[model samples]
Target: MTAPDPAAAAAPSFDIRREVVAVMPHLRAFARFLTGNRERADDLVQDAVVRCLQAAHQFQPGTNFKAWMFTILRNLFYNEGRKNRVKLDPLDEMNAGAHAMPPDQQAGLEFDDFRRAFWHLNEEQREVLILVGASGMSYDEAAAICGVAVGTIKSRVSRARAQLARVMEGGGLGSRTSGNQEMPAEMAAFLAAGTPPKGR
Candidate 1:
């Protein structure tokens, strides 16, 4: 009998890798939205792809590979999120609001302020908001990834927006000044503009 053809054996694997590359733009977008930065997003996507390839056997053929890959990416995000220990820099207490810089300086400070504000949100709320708002995922898809009901996702998104608003306002980075409020109105709209819908 002829020896097994190793090259032939890896052909199927090559096809799977090709499919993954084809979906990379979307995956990168999702990762960037979730992490709120390009470097972290690229790392996340790379990690997800590696994990997916390692667990290729688990994937069922003739099914939705895109969805399957997305599920893997989402799971990895949550797993790492729980382990994230990046500490946020605290504001100076002795010199509260001692900002003496120009408006240009304030602009850069405002970006850092927004980043810190996002870090303050509960993990679940942040995840829901990013998936639904920044990543362009629908409530249903985000809910599935989060393993929660549509209502739960909506609630989380709402609370996230409200919490962000409160944080910005308290930190003197209100919408009128923050320029987009960091949390876009389209994202906050999920909170029904910070109010419940009618008859609720």
Candidate 2:
């Protein structure tokens, strides 16, 4: 068999600007989920596009550029998330699981409920939950990103879960099995200690 020319065998180089534009719709969707504001989502997407273009060389052609760009955008949003709280309706859930309700409708309801429950949690708990549950990061990775210990992350996740349960309960979604569900005292103490003092 004849060997193909090294140059001829190579695929054409990918156009960073073109690619970024093509992914704009998807990027906007991601930004909306991240910031919950159309204007801010546009700004964030523009910023991510600029960053992606600036470091175009970092992207390998014929590979998953979209995923790479998304990762950058997601990280940037997380870095600024606390300063800009995502506005979500309590009726719209992000996780509209398998049911008769349309996915979009269900997601909105889920997002809403999640948003309400999420706010009741302290910062550490919220961050851990979002990182692990929404962003899909592992506990260790979340700890590293937050610059904290693994045990600390574990504790935060546990507390966050408990807090979510309580918040949901307070929202009238708690199971009847758990009568008068309340946030455990120990968990409350941990939360109080871990949360940064206001105006700090």
Candidate 3:
């Protein structure tokens, strides 16, 4: 019997490590969205990264690496949330310092406005929007990551947008500046891109 080469056995682990490094910022942002705290989000990202490295061998070829990592982090967040009874509150307090790229001012929907409108949305609606619309993942990719049907993901994004639009149009949300608000689709995507890594 021929002896197995150590380097050959470890090649996939190397690849996984590199991919994880590249995807870390994204994981942090998503974790912050889910956990609603920077410290807790960082911890979740660390745990998820460890889990990914430990399970590297199980990572299949041709799979979407970012999606896979996101799924792991999300599962961790929900699992821990269940154990700790974490309340899913409005995200105004979460990642207060961290922000996505500023969208067009001409669009007439400021990030502050978008963030406020986002607060009015339910958790599930925000979740799908982040996955599909903000994160720039295709509906199929998002559906796979979210473990839902493509149509379901599409419906969530549509409903989330429509509801947000209505929130802008129909005022009376507490602390939000009074006006007839409008959120362009491109603006949503830009604002969803999130800030850079290391708590920036």
Best candidate, TM-score-wise?
3
- Give the poorly placed runs of model 1, Cα more than 4 Å off: 1-15, 32-41, 60-66, 80-85, 88-120, 174-192, 195-200
Ranking by lDDT: 3, 1, 2
Best by lDDT: 3
How many clashing pairs per prediction, in order? Answer: 0, 15, 0
| Residues 42-120 of candidate 1: C-alpha lDDT, one tens digit per residue | 8888989999989998888776676677778778887884487233233332123334445456454554556556656
Better of 1 and 3 by TM-score: 3
The CA-based lDDT of model 3 is what?
0.71
Better of 1 and 2 by TM-score: 1
Ranking by TM-score: 3, 1, 2
Clashing pairs in 1: none
Point out the higher-scoring one by lDDT: 2 or 3: 3
Residue 114's lDDT in candidate 3: 64
Tell me the deviation in Å of residue 177 in model 2.
Answer: 14
lDDT values, one for every candidate: 0.66, 0.63, 0.71
Total clashes for model 2: 15
lDDT by residue (tens digit), candidate 2, 1-200: 45555765363457565687677876776566556556777888988888887788788888666567666777778776557656544234322232345534534445455455565565557567766676556777666666678899888887778777567555454222234445456544644654545587
TM-score of each: 0.57, 0.45, 0.72
